[model samples]
Target: MYLGRKAIPLISALALSASAFAAQAETDLKFALDWRYEGPAAGFLLAEDMGFFAEEGLNVTIDTGTGSVNTIPRVASGLYDMGFGDMNSLIKFLDADPAQPVTGVAMVYDKPTFAIVGRKSLGITEDPKSVEGKTLGAPPPDGAFAQWPIFQEVAGIDTSTVTVESIGFPVREPMLANGDVDGVFGFAFSVILNLKAQGTPEEDIVNILMADHGLELYGNAILANETFAAENPEAVTGFLRAVIKGFAAAIEDPAAGAAAVVARDATLDPAVEEERLQMAIDMNINTPWAQENGMGGIDAARLDASFEALKAPMGLTGAVGPADVFDSSFLPAAEERMLP
Candidate 1:
């Protein structure tokens, strides 16, 4: 008697388990992106465009969030199963509600891309406190900027003289270029490139790399609530494995990945996508760390530094610890299936 297709394949299951085979049987996942379908988030676009999630039996819908910080509460409230967010904001959400725990599974950018840009002619230097006398543009006067006082104190800049302007994400560069504000807090990789693209003179800006000034934090992480991760560790691990694989592929060929991003969102301009994708590659996806440890590993000490930076800002200086912030189990499991 001839064995059926299923039985025939089973006979050739060299070192593979039935459970492992079943694991790929059409699992649905809800993933939230750090931003809309654009430049900083190009790795995720490549992941979705290249069918990485589909291969893992995941039906993932990439949603564009209005703000970088909103992705956190969305996960805690069960609005999403997983979200892409920064380390600083993620810690705040997790600390506030231990009842609904969330964990960081992967790191998208090995270093912080966050920074502030000022008018170059001022000769005020890249000091954080120097902006105290000038109008400063950042996320908001509330969220992270309020904590700028702490950062300013640490950096030895006098923020007391700084006038804070709460600019949404879009206005940061334009506001500075048009002389609407003296400086703006933004991602140096994106905002600075954009200003140049839009004909903003190179001489008009002096950038203070936030990371260099000691306000370091990781960006674009994969996070899920503890309940879901606990209930389905394998699924979470598999999804992250696919995410890392997709990012690796994207880094190897950003042009192809950028094209993939364009194919997914036809409304997007190719020139914009290409520029954005290249920026993502340089800043996040293909960093030096990814070359060594793969795309998703975390340095615990750096992570701790981020938590420490945010604690005083969020008014949780003594309320939280690193133990409550990150969970590495999912990332390690994902790393196992990858090529070293």
Candidate 2:
């Protein structure tokens, strides 16, 4: 059965039609990240670039977000199908309005990154109490600053003499570096590395991680609109499956992950981004608990304790519970989510 010229063109047409139909069959998902296309976002970006999402029958469109807390309303308002956001903020959001259609589906940062980054030259140190009587810069919408009340209460830091200046995000690090402020509230990875980039000596920097102190709150997570999730449960599961692969790839080769990020934004320094990526992996992503229990799920007992801790500072109405904010049904098997 030798193919003739006429049959060749007809076969090509059929192949093209089949390709178009397959593309149309995929589910379109809009995902919003908590921040810019930085080193931390490598997993998501790499998943898209490596065709992991496509393999999962998903057409994912990821956009950089303004703030972690701000991502809550974006998903709840049906503006996006899913988002990466702070879990503590999500808990507060759900507590305020139990009717919101968004909740966290997968835990990304098992240990919160919230921290008070200070400079030793400016009279700050590793002790949580060292912040007493010092000027601290806090961005109005920062996720870390939102947890200050909790940190203060848990760490028993005397804030009576501490000065908090409401500053913008762009100036938070600059003020700290210039000695205008003693410390700034931000993610440990972001602030510590940014300070180094600004020529601040690494030896002079001190990071007071809230998690290392007494804050039991979880960090950023993958949030899904409940309506979208119920409508497309398979898509949600598939998305998580792909995301697990992405994270595993990132853990295995951080340089490749950094390259994925640099591919998106050419203005970013590759070496700096690589270091940032490694820090996130070491400090946030691949924690001992995550390594032991696998990723993308939470410990119920810890989450309950976190809810209790947040009750006073966040002024909870006792409306939302651990079950209300996190739904782990969409995650892959425990073995599948294991780190490399």
The estimated TM-scores of all candidates read: 0.83, 0.95
Candidate 1: regions farther than 4 A off = 1-25, 121-125, 141-149, 264-267, 332-340
Estimate every model's Cα lDDT from 0 to 1: 0.69, 0.92
- Give candidate 2's TM-score: 0.95
Model 1 TM-score relative to the real fold? 0.83
Q: After superposition, how far is residue 212 of candidate 2 from its true place, in Å?
A: 0.7
lDDT of 1 by residue, 56-106 (tens): 677777787755567777776778878887667667666776666677777
Task: Give Cα distance to truth, residue 94, candidate 1, Å.
Answer: 2.5
State in Å the error of residue 158, model 1: 0.5
Candidate 1 lDDT (Cα, whole model)? 0.69
How close to the true structure is residue 273 of candidate 2, measured as C-alpha lDDT? 87
